[model samples]
Target chain A: MKTLIIIRERDYVWLRTVFPDIHPLLFPICNKPFIEFLIDFSILSGSEAVRIVSDGSLIDVEEYCDNGSLWGTAISYSSIMSMDDQRAVIEKNRRFCSEEKILIISGLVFIQYDKLHDYKSLFASQPNGDLLVCNGGSLSLTGNPPKLQKNSAPLSLSLIALDSLDGYYRLCMEILGFASSPYVLPGYNNEAYCHIGRNVVISKSAEIRKPVMIGNNVQILEDSIIGPGSVIGSNVIIDRKSTVTESIVLANTYIGEQLEVQNKIAAGNMLIEPEGGICITMDDPHLLTGIKKSGSVRSLLRFLVHSFAALLLITLQLIPFLILSPILTIQGKWKKSKNIYYTGTAGETLTLTTTTIERRGFISSLAAALSLDRFTLLFSVLRGRLAVIGSSLELASDSNTTLHEVESWYHAGVFSYAEAEEWPVSGGDKAIVERYFSVHGNPFLDITMTIKAFFNRIHETNTP
Target chain B: MIFHVDGSTGKKLGIAALNGRLDAKNSSELLTSFERWQQQTNLIILDCSKLDLIDSSGLGAVVSCLRKAIEKNGDLKLANLSPKVAMVFELTKAKKLFSIFTDTGSALQSF
Candidate 1:
């Protein structure tokens, strides 16, 4: 059987106010995207193929789910108009729904189903029409219904409309209160009502009362209390003396020292009271704040370290650069170009003379091996404008000046983390590598990466 | 901010109605005004029914006011806290520092 999941934008309008960045379909319910649960149900109902139809932009959902090979199901995506009804959806996907019984799950609804039950047979036996529905959405079947054996037990199915924050919070808490066995919740569960992910660091003085679910890379500080009922997402830090009970702390949030977080949903710096549907974006860092990558002290220390390293490199390479550049330029082996590249800050650009050395003779090869091509950019490190090891230099132009890309800590550098890691120095994966190191790497680690990058550049046959 | 005396409590109860946003920009102003209000009456109730938003600095100022009230052998209670402002207090654990009431009458009576 095949499944078509139609999620209209209007259905999940309320969720946008709470989680603006996330698509409603991709909104996580217990660290798993809502669409994943629907996909799991579709697959369990014996669906060989699944297509997610949406009126809103499905770029994020498409990037995440992508053909659904990870779940062992062929997943596809299609666009629909906001006015498209159930009939229009089926009419549009006529080719897909032609040869088999098509299960049409529409709206922003949560289907409650037990994995232990034989839902495949139950769905096959049930007649086509609206099986279950709530205020926000419905679960209906279209096309043909498979024949079933006589005297089969009725399929037990229920739906919850996720229209408000209260509904969303209740759904999560309800799922968490019970054991996560009914749904495929993320993380490992050794015992009942407790699921934990990897790299969780709990302080010796901290206390954890069970009936809780914690995701990866979590740090519970000294005297902190977690649980009784809590769903802490990945990369969260509950600071010293903080107590988290009956709360859902989302990913990349830092609960400050001596804070009481009870019955709340905290995403980044935004603290939300699910019951009252009140959300406040905190302004103070000490109380509740987002765990961002950049820090003032860290940036200052990085600049000092990079400047010292650049000074040393300049001293060592000064004589070689002086001797080689004159000879190479005289011989037409060294090409120089004046170009303007983007600096670390927005609306800022740096004018620099870039050199491309032709590795033809022994002297030119020595120049290339010594990385004299990037010698001029080392001055940028001393000026505190660039890092010794960071992201590749992006030219200052309309195409390259993407505000989102430039806003990150991926500052222009003479030596890049991608070069050190031997990843592609350009394109999407390179941005990921650079961003990862920019967030995780310290000044001391950057020194090591710089050395690795310098050595890696020595072996390169082409110009950077 | 508007201050008025509550005669129903049969005590020198001061009810201060706070409206609009309380942030770093106006938190110090509130703190300065709170000192003058403290001189009128030791017992006070901060009615936050019209308060739409609050940040950490505003929370700090309120905590400071509570501290001053305690120093003067009196009390500072919160009343009619809007959900949004109440969320800030709860998140910062400032709600535990004061006697919070659902309405100004209750807070004045508690004096």
Candidate 2:
């Protein structure tokens, strides 16, 4: 049997609104990513291959679950339009679903099944129909059973709808409360109801209760109470005297000293009460904050490389800007406007003098080609106020929206990643492209993107 | 901020409607203004319906106001806290220090 998992964007939109940084498929459940559990189940249910299709961007998930070598299953990913029905989805992957019996898992759901169950034989005997059903999703089989050896037995499987934060919290707590967990969870489990990961430094003074799962590279500081029920993700630090019962501390988070963190989801600086789905991004670092992995030796090297590139561009553009800017000004072709934009710092704005060099005569086209309009911004790049290639500047008028969006690796730049890709400047896709490059970009890619952006600007200016 | 007296409940309840943000830039203003509002009637209702955001300092100012009201034998209550702002209070454990209501009218009645 082969498996096809089709999760639509609408099914996981709530996860996007709450946890924007994490893909819904990669959202952790019982210390394992939600997708991994599904994969594990698929492996058990006599599946040799699995295909995951979604309407949203699956690049991150693809990066994570690449070719499914870890599971020893051939896994592939595809994108579908939001309006596509199950029939359309099946039709799209006709070749994969044609030869063998297909086990279709639709929507955002968690399947509850025992690891010890003989699911391979169970699936072979089951008829071509929905094996398990819920409001959120269904597990349906297509094509014929493996053989006609008449078999009748009750199937022990249920679907848990991960529709709301409350549902998610309940599901996690239930998994933790189980005497023996149904699914294979990560970390080292020496005893029941307790799992700890690598490089975990637990203070001798700290008290750890039963029913807890701690991820890799975590530090439980002095006098801390870790659990009666708690799930701590990788690179987390539970500070001194803090009580963390019935809570989940997501990866790369710092819980401050003497704080009570009962029954909440702490992701970075955000503290969310899962029951009510209310969340807050704390500004004060002393209380709760993200332990960012940037500012490393690599980033410092990238900054130096960017500064060198900026200095070269300044040297190249200084002459053209001096020669043509005055000529354009004389002919009233150079238009200048002062706009306030959000700076790198929170609650700070920088006044930038933007220019529009109108195309008219030879000098005008020359000025646009040489990118004299961006001459002043190069200095800002050198001064470390902006990057050579990063996100497009967000206006101060839009600071309210920027305040929310600027949380994840946002930095203003002279040239945007959107320009390198030649995407339309005004759309959601542009932000995606810019953010992708900002987080994933290195000095080498930045140089290539900078060159691409420069020539793209020239091509755009010289179009008409 | 708009300060008014609601006496329909047979008590002088000062209702102050906070607007925009209450961060470090403007938190001190709230603290300075609360002193005058307390002189009129210490039993005050901070209507946070229009308020959008608050930082740690802003939270400090509100807590300070509550303390000042308690010292004067009067009480300060918060009402209509937006979910965003209320989450900050919940995270900081400051929710236990205030009598919070769902609406300004309920806060007035409580006073």
- Point to the candidate with the largest DockQ: 1
lDDT of 1 by residue, A1-464 (tens): 89999999898879876676678888888878899999999998999999999998786788789999999999999999999888998889889889888888899999998878787877787778878878888888777765763334576778999988888888888999874778888888888888899999999999988788999889999999998789898889999999999899988899999888999898888888888787888877888888854457877888899999999899988999999989999999899999887767444778878889898888888999899998988998899887888888878888767653335455888889999998998899998898788767899999999989989888788666
Determine the backbone clash count of candidate 1. 0
- TM-score of each model, in listed order: 0.70, 0.78
The candidate maximizing TM-score is 2
For residues A238-301, write the lDDT of model 2, one tens digit per residue: 9998889899899999998777888899989988888887788887787899997547788688
| Model 2 chain A weakest 10-residue run by lDDT | A399-408
* DockQ for all models: 0.59, 0.37
Best model per lDDT: 2
Q: Per-residue lDDT of B1-111 in model 1, one digit per residue for the tens? A: 999877776798998999998989999988998899988988988999999888878888999998999999988999999877777777767877889999987787776
Model 1 misplaced stretches (Cα beyond 4 Å): A149-152, A293-464, B1-10
Q: What are the clashing pairs of model 2?
A: none
Minimal lDDT window, size 10, model 1 chain A: A401-410
Clashing pairs in 1: none
lDDT of 2 at A256: 86
Off by over 4 Å in 2: A149-151, A199-204, A280-286, A289-302, A319-335, A340-351, A358-369, A383-442, A445-464, B1-111
